[model samples]
Target: MSVFAGRFDGRVAVVTGGASGLGRETARRIAAEGGAAVLWDIDPDWLEEARKDVGAAHAIAFDVRDNAAVSSAAAETVARFGRIDILVNSAGITGATAPVQDFPVDSWLQVFAVNTHGLFYCCRAVIPQMIAQGYGRIVNVASVAGKEGNPNACAYSASKAAVIGFTKSLGKELATSGVIANAVTPATFESPILQQLPQSQVDYMRSKIPMGRLGDVRETAAMVCFMASEECSFTTAATFDTSGGRTTF
Candidate 1:
């Protein structure tokens, strides 16, 4: 919470799933700090409302699972803002909470489509832009469930684990480049995504946290904002933990 009041002055960011959850809050923080944010979301109405509330530079309605759409949005974002200094892949979904045997194949695919495939599409579309500028930040929003698999949430957990792996590989590939890539594993937070979970699941998550509660959006966003800034130059392909002491490793 220290004031980096103009930390992002003249910067541009592309935030996926920016209409709500941690994405929205991160967009707000960036815009408030003087960066131009291009908010992308699957919900047209929600995206528009976020643009208005955050005063984002652009509001894009698109599905990240669609490679073409992600590519087009990246192009449009660069055209409008000139450069994409930061990329935050915060969009994800928790598929039906059920055991692997009981989990619908369709639901599993859908979860991976958004959480894994969507992330790949967004990063693929923008990494070249970051490399061209000789400087950029990519923050992939993963979950602690990835590291410690949650029972009955096979799809969600596996997808996030893939995210972590992808980020690690990307970090190594970009090691010598100016662009840095990292992933954050946040424990259960009071975000819109929580609504998708049953009360039992939610409570079970909270119970594991050493802090005995969920993390706040601002706390998670603060870590993300830092990772997205010039201050994060030395770290890449790293996993940041915002898990309220639940993850000591």
Candidate 2:
């Protein structure tokens, strides 16, 4: 049963990275609350399964790193759903764990390509639709490392910081346009993304959290859902922190 029944009764949400992790969790919550979630991910097989699990209105598999693909997906969504009321940019990657001096240039670029540029593409493609409709909510999933850089994880840290900066600029630009944009900074969390990192790196992150525990995806999803809701009326261009007390600012 939905705790906030009818909160998203008529809304349509487009969630990137919806195949797994926080994206999937958020989509599940939105659908439970009556929103028509449209799941987007780079994996078609996983995307199809998630579409059934989340009860999504649609599921499209495409690379967010490709602006043309992102644009096409946005148009397809508008064509089928009539309008997009929310966008949750949850697609990201954790590049190879290495010191700045040893970090592979290719790894750094790929991280930015997905974690930063992919997000930009999604926002660019969808914002026009939101503007035409006079209302929309955008929640970009950033990271606590973005605020305080993590050792040996230079690319992920820098890319997320860029996400925060980009969100601020976009929020200000759309402030008066009836489209609200915000970013969420989460601490080390129990997520599939963690699997991409080595145990030592994970342990290092866990050590930094004052709470001494990884955040549950549900906790972060709760924050995202609220920000995606019409109830988030007064906040825009702000960073909502879910860093388990790791980041107070």
RMSD of candidate 1 to the truth, in angstroms, is 1.0
**Tens digits of per-residue lDDT for model 1 on 1-249?**
338888999999999999999999999999988899999999999999999998798989999999999999999999887999999999999999999889999999999999999999999999998899898899999999999989999999999999999999999999998999999999999999998999999999999999999999999999999999989989998999999999877
Residue 91, model 2: lDDT of 94
Q: Report, for every candidate in turn, its global Cα lDDT versus the true structure.
A: 0.94, 0.95
**Highest-TM-score candidate:** 2
Show the colliding residue pairs in model 2.
Answer: none
Superposed on all Cα atoms, the candidates' RMSDs to the truth, in angstroms, are 1.0, 0.6
Q: Which pairs of residues clash in candidate 1, taking residues 3 or more apart in a chain or in different chains?
A: none
Candidate 1's C-alpha runs over 4 A off are none
Score candidate 2 by TM-score against the native. 0.99
lDDT of 2 by residue, 1-249 (tens): 887989999999999999999999999999999999999999999999999998888999999999999999999999998999999999999999999899999999999999999999999999988999999999999999999999999999999999999999999999999999999999988999999999999999999999999899999999999999999988998999998889968
Q: What is the C-alpha local distance difference test score of candidate 2?
A: 0.95
**Per-prediction TM-score:** 0.98, 0.99
Off by over 4 Å in 2: none
